[model samples]
Target: MSPRNSLLLVLGMASALLAQGPDLPIDPANSFKVNLPGDGPLALVSADWGRSSATARGGAMLVDLHSTLVFKNSSPRPIRGVSLLVLAQEVTPGGKASVTVPSLDIQSGESFPIRVDLRLMRPLNAGSGALVQVGLDGVLFEDLTFYGPNRLNARREMLAWELSARRDRKAMLSTLLQAGPEGLRRQLLSVLARPADNLVMGMQVARALPPTNIDPGRVVEFAFLQFPDSPVELLSGEARMTGTEARAPRIEIQSKSKRPIRFVELGWLARDEQGREFMAGTLPADLSLPPGAHSTIRRENTLRFAKPVNGLTAYPSAVEYADGELWVPAYSSLKDPRLAAALPASGEERRLAQLYRRKGLEAVVQELRALR
Candidate 1:
């Protein structure tokens, strides 16, 4: 063959070889992965399962879930006949039961939206609520082949569990607090201090803290007063300081747990320059914090739209806007000396002042846009 032709032949052979090489194994762990529409998978994405007002009807416990299932298909192939399974477990001690939608199809490269209308035929036998487990179980192929739980989709399921757990915990805490301080404490002790065979409930209880005792000019911190196995630690005694405006102010907390600790919720009572008291929720935007190390939970000037404006200001007076109504901390009161020292000095207080000066409504909207 001519030299040029020979070179061409060799290149052709190399290209063929590359094409024929074995395909990389799909991560066994991700074999069940399914990508939904929207930002990503529906399994792990946070969703609200819309609420239903329950009224006793005879002996049956009646609850309905009127929520949309947003499915995004990132795959090249069209998806047809998707099955979604929702497990509704009684909150009290009992066996679990579920509902299933066997076949729903979606076009390839398209988003499929489904509204799940669920009715709980049997009320939770014992507990005040029920645990709802929603998942995508099967995807049907055109050729009659079946795909089980997609690992990616399974991840979405895990995320759903997390989101549900968080919401439930919040509801539980809110109910407890509504019963008043003593009621809150009783609920905490019963839920947290008690031992349970249900891992989910235990985990939820593990994150619950006692309500704060709000006092003017105080910063109260609650450590893992009970759970030694807790995945978090309280590094420094909670310190309170005043006068944080320009610079970001933070509290240094040391952790002994191996798992990462995200500040899911933070409660505090403070007074603004006007001497107006308020209850505040101080958890940062990005909730995740490292574990087995010292970390700082800082107060930034940025406002979050998702957080309500009720709790942002200190009690008696509303400074800025309330993000959410503040709750009392678990152990110490707002007047505790330890709490008072935790407040920031003047320079550190600028962020909050700026937020209020700009007006909370506009500032929060801008902050939300920045997140996008």
Candidate 2:
């Protein structure tokens, strides 16, 4: 039997079994099925697929999914968190239509439900019931360890790329320093003219933008609006804007937690007294504030925007902290999705992916491994 027919037969059997239970109202035959490897401590209890709709998006069929997955901890160890990347691989290869289900905790032998509400774009002729194969990808532990097949191997690939990119950056900086201004300008132009083979090189070339002479007297004036209510209080600070540039000097902050903060992202917003608002962007500052310590940080941001602004009131709308393991949003705070969309992918990532498409994974690995 073809895989599609086998899946249909299995769906029929599962449907009959599910129909026997009073709580299972969903029809299994109509629902897309997902199969997970059975070697893990967490076991799939039941998956109730919800309604699906199809539409056209950019010459492809976009499938909107609404489903829930129930996983029970079958092992003795309590699970504090589970991060999963639910992928509809058969419908869209390379797992383009995947969603990272937010982390959730499940106690030993207890079942927890994860709701999926994401879109999947597939070939127009793939058909609605073309045996949509689903794969669960990503790490399964609090310490961020992988237990399943790394189909994408995104983690390792990114790690290798980042390590290599850092080395390339250091090398470029040393070379540029030794070359001086005229040589640096020539090298920058040459790198920019070449095809983007490496993101590190591209970024290094981009950062060599000719320094702008700011008119100190004509710099757009800005007032210190109230800082977002956060654990880190802004004790003293001032910011000035000058044509896509924002300079924050003498910024002081106090950390209330015992854990040292490694980084902070303060989202910028401009507001008027009449209630008009604009998402200015984000001011990301790296810091080393020891436990319950006070620290000062400086930021120089080249804000990208085309809108005219009257810096009547400018302040941070959100905050995030990297307490060691990971960067978490501040208490009762969430990142504005619009801001995230505006940000560009890391230079190394774009260049490496392009390299992969042009040269292949072997070439990518060779280049990465060759990095000192």
Candidate 3:
């Protein structure tokens, strides 16, 4: 931008910040700006400049921003997800951050909320305008149509979330249709009673495994839990283990179904010495394999578990086809007794149950109806 335009833009932003109520903790010049395209599928309804700060550290500025942005779905279809791009350093590509909210079921003209919490580091005396600029990166509709520049690959991620949400919702709606309210209650109770996802303490994820603190470990051959409708087959795989870390992992698999597979995620699991199994995060690999074609998925970083694992196993957790469609473990498959503690409640399940708890059962029924 030219210097004349920059001066006007900065002055306008400063004046707007000063117009905010008094006793402001954030300096006007050090604040951020919201820039939403007027012709997009979503329209900015309001922006609340919530708590924010800019502290000088050495020759740089530490900017922390927290804001609530409300947007209306101006499109004709229901929105499944929204991703906002937060640009803290316009010139530096790495300084960009993205916030994506998935599993949304917003209808036309419906308003939704997005919370932006970001921390950035930039030169103390930096560019014009606010310290950050928030703009729309993408929006995924219920029909799989996407809007905006997909700079962050929001299309695939949003579609995956939508697919999962739809699958879980269909299962729940079917339960209600077949068994009535009592049966549905039993199902929700079972889901709510399952063990919650555990947080692995001191888990450090890196592209490569640590060299030191090696455990006198042996090679671990992977095992798989077969799903009836799985489109891919795991042939063979193993990980090099050293004490608590596993590295140089490799797995071979072949597509068994007709669809062209594009993305694969393995449900990595580890069994501790105490005879208990815990989820060891997912191994995501990009593939361009057709039906009956085999490929090897390799990772440079070896397997690093939060704790010493006695055994390791994997299963196809989710898969995406080349057509932007997804296939997740069947709701029934995920309900297996062995997987009860491994996977958390589905997004739709948690959402419906929360609605039922807060607003009663009828609200959930209405929501399911609207979704259908």
Candidate 4:
């Protein structure tokens, strides 16, 4: 953050009333408010609004939201994910925010927490009546179903994370069963100690067709990173690329499964000029491909970056069936030596690592077993 930017934390609540912290430097009254429905699959249990403040800088204002909310799975199904909408300033064009909690395994009648943390800027004259509004955006259940508004496309994102969570847990459990506690400990330690991948090379994406008759680079065919469990088989794929941009991605696929596919997201790993590879973004397409059928997915979206990229490898990242069931790349496939370095840790992996850090290895093991 720059020196001119300020951050204030919105922090407390229990049950039906909102709780405030002590010694706060008095922000604008009613600057932050949270609205949650009581009749949803997950009911609001409590909120610990930590401490929130608004700072005025001439005609602009900075608001910080950082808090944890507690909710219970009041419905009969397990909750896989949740998303909370954070309204920074209703008057601002892009002032909205969302907090999504994925890789959750909260069973019926169980309690879970969602943490919201973001720094937003708004006009000072926006209003004193709730400078920020927090509400429900979406929730995903264990049965591959969803509740709440589908505003943020949280359904697919959460489902993908949940699938990854399940994969990670099973993978670690397999390690524990085969090699015992020491081996499992080593595995967890390795992930916890692993440093984050250096993916700092930036990219600008435009969802429109690339400019015609321009310096669009040569055509590049994508190399496949095949997964045995993937529902779709990649026949061929290619994209137009320049030193600073990749555009007009087109891929042909065949459904190998009995169920029809409704959605598929392809992720590519690109190598920079320095030979360092990073996960470039995903290209999600919503379509229908029946069993033993072939289809082609195309997009005019263009991705531009400062550093040149080689679209080295492409893989199936997320796939959803017509029945609303989702499929993610298996953990075993992601553990390939080729991908182990480029791929980032899943949400559940991060949670387990944090659990080990805060509560010890035994706690993680116990949680994993309980979830199982």
What is the per-residue lDDT of model 3 for residues 1-372, given as tens digits with 9 covering 90 to 100? 999999999999988665432332456445777787888888888887677776665556667778899999998999989999998786653467899999887999999899988887666567556777888889998778889898877877787788778889888889888988778878777766755556231234568744554454567788887788888989999877765777778899999989899999888767877867776778789989898899999888766677877777789988888986778788788777767666667778887787777887777777666656
**By lDDT, is 1 or 2 better?**
2
The TM-score obtained by model 4 is: 0.76
How close is every model to the real structure, measured as TM-score?
A: 0.24, 0.38, 0.84, 0.76
lDDT of each: 0.38, 0.49, 0.78, 0.77
List clash counts for every candidate, in order: 56, 0, 6, 11
Full-model lDDT, candidate 1: 0.38
RMSD values, in order shown: 24.1, 23.9, 9.8, 8.4
Q: Write the per-residue lDDT of candidate 4 for residues 184-205, one digit (tens) a residue.
A: 8888888777665464346566
Residue-level lDDT of model 1, residues 1-372, one tens digit each, is 899999999999988766544332222222222233343223333343554333343444344546665666555554544556554443422223233332234455566666666664444353433334456655544333445555333322222223333333344345444665455444434443322221111001112122234522345343322223333434433433222311223445554544554433443443445543333434322345455566665654322222222212221111011221112232223224533343321211233234434664345234323423
Look at candidate 4 and tell me the lDDT of residue 270.
Answer: 82
Question: Per-residue CA lDDT of candidate 2, range 161-265, in tens?
Answer: 333345443444444457654443453444334443221111000111234465441244444444254556656655454443344434666776656676655
Worst window of 10 by summed lDDT in candidate 4: 7-16
Clashing pairs in 3: 215-243, 246-302, 246-303, 247-302, 247-303, 248-302
Question: Residue 100 in model 4: shift from native, Å?
Answer: 0.4
Task: List the candidates ranked by lDDT, beginning with the highest.
Answer: 3, 4, 2, 1
